[model samples]
Target: MKVAVVGGGPAGYVAAIRAAQLGAKVTLVEEGELGGECTNWACIPSKTLLRAVEVYKEAAEYLQDLPKFDWKAVQSRRWAVVKRLREGIEKLLSMNEVEVVKARAQPAPGRAVKADGRVIEADALILATGSVPAPLPNLPFGGKVLDTKSALLLEEPPSSVLIVGGGAAGAELATLFAKVGSKVVLVEVVDRLLPALDADIGRTVERELRAMGVEVYTSSTVLSVDDRGRAVSARLKTAKGEIDLEADYVVVAAGRRPNPGPFADLVKTDERGHVVVDGQMRASAGWVYAAGDVAGPPYFAHKAYAQAKIAAEAALGRKAYYEPLAVPAVVFSDPEVASVGMTEDEARRAGYDAKSARVPLSISGMGLISGGAGFVKLVYDGNSGRILGVHAVGRRVSEIAGEAALLVEFGATVEDLALVMHPHPTISELLVEAAELAVGKPTHIAKRGP
Candidate 1:
């Protein structure tokens, strides 16, 4: 069988490689960067900048004299990292014997992809065109109004920025600029930052952002923006009523919609233009599969990677499916926030008798030594004692999210987690201690009264 994967991103490249491994002739097509948005623009570049900001923040207090940060050098380093990783993807595709074509691919007549004025016929086709930023009405990408792509390519940090979304992307960028001495105002239409996480987790992140000097205005919307050359002026509607604000740039991190590209009419997409796939990652047609941001919500690179494998295997006549009970999300803020599985409200809405417990990270020896302030929250089924969800916020809590994901995925009970015996003087111990608190064991701190 021959397989053709369009959009050489995390999903497309991985799908191409997987199909090649399954004894199929694979052709991969990409118009721009082979590593897609994650490597070229979004994930890699943003994280590299954020990491530098984190280092400066960690040392700012301890050192009396700190050298000024170099924006050009940071930009150079970010591009360098992107270039190396993109080359690595290219090498992997070559090793797998997948034909790599650099061109914009369009759907051709009958199971074929047309790219660079040539058609590649295949028995199966996988669409992974990924996504583009959702544009705000009246506030398009130009002048001082920027999308995520343009925001990262800024020559130097802005004197002031008004970020018009409080999602993970906006929050991370807000934290980055505030630490780098830019006055930042983060506005979210929703009631909290990181709206997808548990409420308390979002509140904790808001606190951390304020600590870093970011002025956060939740339940706020940017009604309009005017670029006056010298500065951008924006009218915002908040709980306190409408107000006018000015900044060097207004960033719209509101959200992203699936690119779909040339495959829009070929497959079924949701109202928001995301491909609607079955449990096996198959779209409207059996021979046509979709993955990554083009596939749907969550829109995570790791989720795209997993879906790529599933789509490839399913196309190869294998019994593979993308059935995940828990997906972990991490925000690389000063104090990282991570969450997996259901929130307490979600569990209850799903008809589970859920009960939750919280253990402060400050109580742990590692937390005390590190001087970090955050907490671990565990949501479990009160009736069956099964773990429902795990949410955490603190330094390096992103790493702990993996274990939380596993417990939620496996349906581990509070008693099971409490008995596992986590190592002493570690961040992970908070998970066990939270579990103990849930099962009435009380190992780390005094048991809370019912």
Candidate 2:
């Protein structure tokens, strides 16, 4: 059977490769260059901008420990990296034996896709078409009223920026602006920064941002933005009533929506405009599968890849299905954040009697090695001893996301992880220690002898 994988991104390309691996004639279509929003705009570009910020922060804050870092040269080289990576993805799709079509994909049911006035019919269709930056209705994004995408594209950093959201994207960019020497003040409508993150993790990051001189406001709203090409004046709602905040730029990192309206009449998208898909990434409309950011949240690239693999299998008349145990998330902020599985709230909602343990990384061996400051939190069921959730916050501690995710994925207990030997003085030791601590049999802790 022939398959047409629409939207050439992590999802589309992975699906194409998977379909080809399954011995199918696969053709992939994308409106832009390969890698979709990830390479072109979202994940990849955001990281490019933050790399500059990370280096700059490391030089000043971690100078003695991190070694000599060329701040100026490193930041300047991002464009070259982005340019090279973008080209590499294009080349990868070409080498995959999947015919690549660069044209806007018009989604149609029953394994049909239209592109730039040409119709491609296949036995199966994979709609990996990605997402767009969420619209700000009253406060529209323009030249000065920027979104995360535009914020990354600036040749020179602004003097100051007022970020309008305190989620992962907003918080990361706020850190970026601060590192690049922008006087930044992040405003969130919620009670805390990164409401999506666990309160403890969010608090840790919030404290770090405050220590870095980035002003954060909880329970605040930007009423409207007055854009004047070079600056934006915002009327905001705060505890002390209305106040005006001025900045060189305003970033709307509040949210994102599926890039589906173009293919609206063709697929079954939910009320909120996200493409609805079953376990195998199959759309309600037959033979049309959806994956990636367009599919839903916990919107990590890895999740999309997994979904794409299953979508490819299902498209080929294989009886494969997707049963993801854990979908991990890592935020690329200064003292990064990572999580997997359910939140405590999620477990409670699902009617599980849950318990969680929070550990500050200041006590870990790896934390001492990296001269650490942050935490590792493990949330699990009290009765079952099965891991339900895990959250981490620390400087470079986010790299251990894989190990943390593994424990959640396998339902590994604290004692189970304690038996596994971890490399001495590495960040992974923290995960081992955190899990051991969970079973009330912590190796490193002072145990009361029987």
Candidate 3:
């Protein structure tokens, strides 16, 4: 099979490599750097910077007279990380014998793509053009108004920043700036931060952000912005009332929109312009496939990787599908938040007799020693005792999400989780503890009457 993959992102590159591994001749077309936004801008860069803040805050607890943060050095290191990863992708593509073309590609008729005035014929086409930052109303990206990509490129952290939207990016940025001593005012149109996750997760994150001196205004929207060259003044309609704020920069982290390029007209797209794909990651046009942010939400690189693998295999006449029982969502904020499967509300809405148990991280020996706060919540089918979801927020909780995902994926029960032995003095024990509570075998916390 001859495969042509568009946009060398997490989705495209992975699809190309997989297709090549399946004995297909593949050509990957990308206008920008390989690894796409996740590698160059959003995920990798942001996490790199956030890790810097994490280290500083961890050291501050025990050290005295810390040196001032060097933004330039951090920026250099962030780029270095990006560069190294990009080279790794390049080498992978080369070793796999996947041809890479550095040019903008357009889907041509008859399972072909046109790039740089050349038509590349293929038996299957994979679209993974990724997405761009969604612009906020009355606050276009320019000058002091920044998007997530541009915000990371700033030479120095602003003395004050007003961030719009309280999703993963907004919350993480708020954490990054506030922890580094920048006054951050975060505004989310929704009622809570990370509105897509469990309500408690948002509440925990909001509490932590407030502790970091980040002014959070949920159920709010920025009405207008008046950029005055040096700074920007924004009028916001918050839950309390209308308020005005000034900041060195106004960052619009509202969300992202699919960058499907010329393929939108060729394939089925949802109302949000995301290319609609089926279980096999096949577009309405059976020969074409779409993955990553361009395909839909829960826009994580890992999700892209899974979908890309399915798309490549299915496209190459293999029996693969993009069916997953649980896909993990993680936010790298202070006291990181991670969740898998449905929330309690979602489980009930899905027609399950859902019940949940919550156990604070403080109950764990490691959590107490590590100064961790927040709780681990397990939403399960009350009748069957099968674990439906796991949501957690705490220091290093991100590591637990993999196990949480597996529990939901394999339909493990609360009893199963409780029976499994977790290493002693580890934060991961919170899951076992929560499971024990759910099964009426409470440990490390006071038992409640049924």
Candidate 4:
């Protein structure tokens, strides 16, 4: 089958690679760079800048204890880190023997695609056109008013920034700027930051942001942003009253919107313009499909990868389906934030009769060794005693999400976790303790009742 993937993002790129591996004739079309937003704009660049802030923040914050590194030296290294990775992605697709077409694609099902005034036919068309930052209805984007995509491209850190939105990107960037010694004020319209995480987890994350000297205001709205050439004036509505914020730069990490507005009739999309896919990552029509951020909820790279594989395989006449038991959500902050499966609220809302256990990693040997504030939370079905959700926040806990994620995938109970032996003084050890604590026989249980 001749497969053409639209969009050069994680979903599209992975689908192309997977289709090629499956012995299909695959050609990928991308409008901008090869790696899509995740590689070029969204994920990779944000983390690269965040890493710079991590080093800079730690040295300055822990000057007496930790060895110092020159801030200018670290700042100088960021361009090299991001540029090389972007170039490396371009090389990888070429190495895989997949034809990389650099153009914006207009897809016609089971027919051909038009890009850059050229036409190409394919047996299967994968639409991974990805997303762009959602616009604030009252405010426009320009001047000192920037989005997360533009924020990463910045060479010098802003003296002060007002970040709108409290999702992963907003929260992460706010913390990053604060760590880099920028005065960052983050405003979320919701009741809490990281609304995707459990309320408790969100609370903990908020505490961490405040500790970093970030001005976090929940239940707030950015009424308008007026650019003043060098800076911007933001009219915000806080819980207490309306307030005006002075910002050298205004970063909007609000949300994202799916592309291809005209294709909604040909495909499935939710009310908010995100593509809707079935269990097999297929649309209402058998051949039409969607994945990645465009596909709606739990928009993460790993989820996109899994969805792409299923979408591509099924498209190629395979019997594959993409119903992930656990889709890990990882936010790479200083101490990181990782979550899988349901939140406590989600469990209760679903009528699972669930109970939860929360354990601060500070009590764990690994937390002490890492010299960071870390914590883990496990939510379980009270009747089935199966693992429902796992949340961790700490240094390197993002990497350790797999350990707890597997338990979620396996429908494992606290008992199931007891059998596995985690290495001592490691981040993963906290997951086991959290699971054990949920069952009331934990070695490091914090409390008796949930």
Best by TM-score: 3
TM-score of model number 3: 0.98
Candidate 2 has an lDDT of 0.80
lDDT by residue (232-314, candidate 4, tens digit) is 88899999999998999988788878774445676767888877777777776566667788888666788788889998998
- What tens digits encode model 3's per-residue C-alpha lDDT throughout 326-384? 99999999879999999999999999999999999888888887666899999999999
Full candidate order by TM-score, most accurate first: 3, 1, 2, 4
Give me candidate 2's TM-score against the actual structure: 0.93
Q: How many backbone clashes does candidate 1 have?
A: 0
Which lDDT value does model 4 have at 257? 80
Order of quality (lDDT): 3, 1, 4, 2
TM-score of each: 0.98, 0.93, 0.98, 0.92
lDDT tens digits by residue: candidate 2, 49-125: 77766655656665566544444465467656767887887676667778988887775545577877878888887
Worst 10 residues of 3 by lDDT: 363-372
Tell me how far the alpha carbon of residue 354 in candidate 2 is from the true structure, in angstroms, after superposition: 1.9
Could you tell me how far off, in angstroms, the CA of residue 381 lies in candidate 4 after the best superposition?
1.7
The runs of at least 3 residues in candidate 4 whose Cα sits more than 4 Å from the true structure, single-residue gaps closed, are: 61-76, 108-110, 261-265, 284-286, 445-450
Model 1 TM-score relative to the real fold: 0.98
lDDT of model 3 at position 322: 84
